[model samples]
Target: MQQKIIILDFGSQTTQLIGRRVRELDTFCEIMPYNKFPKDDPSVIGVILSGSPYSVHDKEAFKVDLSQFVGRIPVLGICYGAQFISYANGGKVEAADSREYGRANLEHFDAENPLFNGFVENSQVWMSHGDTITAIPEDYKCIASTANVKFAAYASTKQPVWAVQFHPEVFHSLQGTQLLKNFVVDICGSRQDWSADSFVETTVAELKAQLGDDKVILGLSGGVDSSVAAVLLNKAIGSNLTCIFVDHGMLRKNEFR
Candidate 1:
């Protein structure tokens, strides 16, 4: 069984980037909209709450019942995810005096904390949110902070929940990948075994078992996903697989030719 990380997307534009970074770390992850977050999954070792464009204070903003997996699994929140965790736990979030949308230095942070194990003091981080966490709940402690954002990051004293007010998925934030590695590898205890070879091997085996001697027809879309699927099918059933490509009139000039 593959160890997995679940990312609850709140419509953040960079939500996919979060999953991409996680996969790059050799850990498999799935991104689902907050409303459709799964309830029970034994393979899920960690959960990530993605940022959103909407404010946590907004009544119509996307919300989820954190109790579903808060204390049971390790959780890391980013940007809006951080504010939502604070706001949900009786903390306070308010519009910032100014919208922070660029690089900021981490003036102070808890070096002893596992989240910042390899992080250096005064390291740069990417910030891009309009709201800031003004106060944290009693059970949560501020673990990191910037010159502008007081509660730039916090960890729950009672639960396995940690959050950051910056965008760690983006490359602009130096040492961001290290932070993610600490969370997913050190804290969550995930074995970095998920890789292209592993995926192909596992997928091929499953395909062979489910499609044994069965002829399969695939639609080739000239895209990465479909092309990969075609390759997998070919590898599984050899001459039993048939591929059909359609000229949908949407291809580039002379693509059909």
Candidate 2:
């Protein structure tokens, strides 16, 4: 089975961007709302907590029960997500006297860590939150920091938890994309082995097994993945396979024209 990554959204503006970034790595990923996660998917290798507009000190701010993933799976938190990580695990975060926003250079980064694998020291990172992580849980260790924020990036040496104050999914983050690639490709130890060619080959065998003399129809989206899937199915079923393209009005400009 193809390994997958799950991004848990917390009402962040760039929530969808995170998924886009992961897909660029030639791997598949899905963004599920905080409440819409599937209960059965062992292939999910990691969970990313998105930043939110809510402050940790606000009584009406969003809250969730993360006990399910704290110690079991790899979890990464960003901005408000990081704060939540600290608070949920017995750390501290409060309103900053001066809201730190906009461009800020990271002071130091642990190059040995996967998050900083391709990142150079004194790299510029995008920051966009008011709350700061003052203290971290006993299990978490600070890996990188800027001048204004002491706990910029942290990870649990004991568990599969990682958090960062910067927006790695944003274009403004100079080395942000590299950081994400390091985490997903290196830290997670994903083979990057999943690809459209593999899918096509696998589906061909599966289709031959199921539809030897039977007929089958595939709804193709003209997408790379779906196109490959269609070819695979066709190779197995031959004349028995039918390809149908459905026209939907929701596609971008000229997508269906």
Candidate 3:
């Protein structure tokens, strides 16, 4: 089975981008809603907590029990994820005197840290949070700081937990992808073996085993997913796979011609 990275989405608009970045590194990932987070599984090599619109101090803010995977698997929190981690671990996170958005430069960070590997001082990052972590727990050490936010990035001294107050999944962050690569590859030790070709090979083998002599019918919409599915099925069972394409009468001008 391919190792997987799980992302707990707290309703961030950019949460999907995190999964996209991880996939770009040839690593498999799945995004689950915070409330519907899955239990600890061996296939899961790491966990990422996505940002949210609600503040950690709010009564109705989304909550989850991090004890389930905090020490067992590598955890990387972003924005609200960072605040939630700090607030839950005897740290302090409060509203900033002024809202911080757009691009910001890192004032200082530990060059020796694994997350900051290959990252330069004063690297640009995207910030979109209103609350900042003012202090951290005894075991947590601030690793990166921006001019306005004190604890822009932090890691636990005793655990594999790390966090950042900026949106590293966004393009505005200079070393965003590299940071994710470090976590998923270097820190988490993911094999980074997931790819479209491997997916097709495994899927075809499974389909052949499941349907030895049975015939299958698939609907093709000329869209990416359905087209890919049809191809895989055809490769698996050859002539036993039949494809049906329906005309919805929504095609563009001269589409059928």
Candidate 4:
């Protein structure tokens, strides 16, 4: 079984970006829908809860039972993930006086905390949410804080669970990648064994097995993404792979086409 980090997507636009950022760390990860958690998978080493557009108090908010992950596996929550877990438990998450968004600097933080392992004094983080955590349960301790947001980051004293209001996966966060690295590499203790080379080698083998004597046509957008995908598919099944490209046509295409 291949070890991987499981990211529970709560319909956040930046959720895939988080997956990309984690993979950049040479660690394999999967983005599962919010409610569809892989409870019995021992291959999962960590879990990341992605942000969402809906509030925790919404009439139609998506939710999951955190009990399945909390003490069993390392957990990292971002934005709505942070709020929902807090609100669902005994903590208090309230509507911010104003929707806080964009760049913010950490005014106070515990430099000794595992998550803030290489963080400098003025670490900048990207925030995008209308709600904020006012208080956390007694078992959790504040690890990082911004001038406006007191609960910028928190961690469980008894377990490896942690939560942050910022989006470290975004580009604006200066040390955001470092934070992710700390959580993934330091806290979660991932071997850092997965990489693009390994991904290609493993994927090609899997594709070959799954598509035995089968023809496949993958859509291409003339972008590096699909182009590389075409290469991988071609490697997997030889001439059995075919692709369709867009016309009118962005040579530097966006995947959303």
Candidate 5:
């Protein structure tokens, strides 16, 4: 089975970027809804908790049982993910005195930890959270900090849990990719064997097994998703695939063409 990372999306604008960075590390990763957890699947090597637009302190904020992923596999949380893990783990996540946005410098980080293996002293990082992790559990310790934000980063001493208040997926953070590399490659022990060929091979095999000898019909839309699906289905079943382009007759001029 191919090893992969799972990123739980909490509706952050940069969720896709996080997946992109992971793939760029030559590792396969899938993003699922925040509340969804792939139960007992061995293909998963690590789990990432993504940031959210809503604060962890919000009455209607997104919630998930951190216990679902923490001890089971290596976990990395970013922005809202960091805050949520802290808040859920009996830590204190309070509304910040002010929104800590934009560039911040990590004045101190634990060099002994594998997560910060390649980090430079006073490294730059992007921060965009409305809440701060004021306190954490006794088993968890601060791993990194900015002059302004004391608890900019943290990790659990007992489990495979790590989190950062900064936005490492953004381009502004120069060493952001390195941090992700450290997490996905080092901490997660994921092999850099994911490739386009492997993806096509596995997906086509699954499609063939699921759709054997059965005809498939797909709506022909010129959009990215539909187009890609059409190609994949065509590859899987060949002549058994039928495409019906539904022109609702309400398209703008030249749209049907």
Candidate 6:
């Protein structure tokens, strides 16, 4: 079975964007609320906790039980997600004098960690959080730090967990995409086998097994998804599949010549 990434959403507005970034890397990724994640899945290659606008210091702040992931899959926590990991694992966080929002520099860093694998000191990163992590869990080692937060980035050798105090999935973070790619491709060790073609083949086989010798009609618009779906159906049911592409009188000049 191909390995997959599981992103535990903590209600971050940017959570879906995280999945988009992962998919952009040609790797299959899924997003589920922290509470709705599957219980047992050794095939789960990695977990990324998304940044939320909520503050972890509040009593009713969104929370996800990390007990199931403590020592298992490689985990990366962002912004609010980082605070959750820190506070849950015996670290300390306090409401900053003010929200630390906007661009900041990674004054100090460790290039060895996959998060900063290709980043240099003084790299710019996007930051937006009211609460800041001042300390980290006892088992975790601090890999990167900024002036404002002593524990900017940490890795737990004992738990395969890593957390960053920045929004690494955002385009403003200069090297944000690289950081994600390193974590997903390098640390998670995910295969680059995820693509439209792979999905088409898998779906075709599954459909054939489920509807053997059954006549089926598959219709699709010319959009990417519909096109792909139509191809899968055609592969599975062959001549039995019929596609309808209507030219709603909205074609570009010379489109149907």
Evaluated with lDDT, which candidate comes out highest? 1
lDDT of 1 by residue, 143-174 (tens): 99899988889999888899999988999999
Give Cα-based local distance difference scores for all models.
Answer: 0.92, 0.82, 0.91, 0.90, 0.90, 0.83
Clashes of each: 0, 0, 0, 0, 0, 0
Cα lDDT of candidate 5 equals 0.90
Better of 4 and 5 by TM-score: 5
Q: Better model by TM-score, 1 or 5?
A: 5
- Which portions of model 6 show Cα errors greater than 4 Å? 211-257
Top-scoring candidate (TM-score): 5
Inter-residue clash pairs, candidate 1: none
Candidate 6 TM-score, true structure as reference: 0.80
The order by descending TM-score is 5, 1, 4, 3, 6, 2
Candidate 5 lDDT over 13-102, as tens digits, reads 999999999999999999999988897889999999999999887788899987777898999999999998888888998888888789
Q: Which ranges of candidate 4 are over 4 A from the true structure?
A: 216-230, 241-257
Please give the lDDT score at residue 176 for candidate 1: 94
Off by over 4 Å in 1: 246-257
Worst 10 residues of 5 by lDDT: 246-255
lDDT of 4 by residue, 84-136 (tens): 77777789989999999999999999998889988899798999999999999
Q: Write the per-residue lDDT of candidate 3 for residues 135-250, one digit (tens) a residue.
A: 99889999998878889899999999999999889999989999999999999998989986787799999999999999998877667778898998898899999998866687
User: What is the C-alpha RMSD, rounded to one decimal, of candidate 5?
Assistant: 2.1
Better of 2 and 5 by lDDT: 5
Q: Which segments of model 3 are wrong by more than 4 Å?
A: 208-257
Give me the overall lDDT of model 1: 0.92
Error of 5 at 38 (Å): 0.7
Runs with alpha carbons beyond 4 Å of true place in candidate 5: 246-256
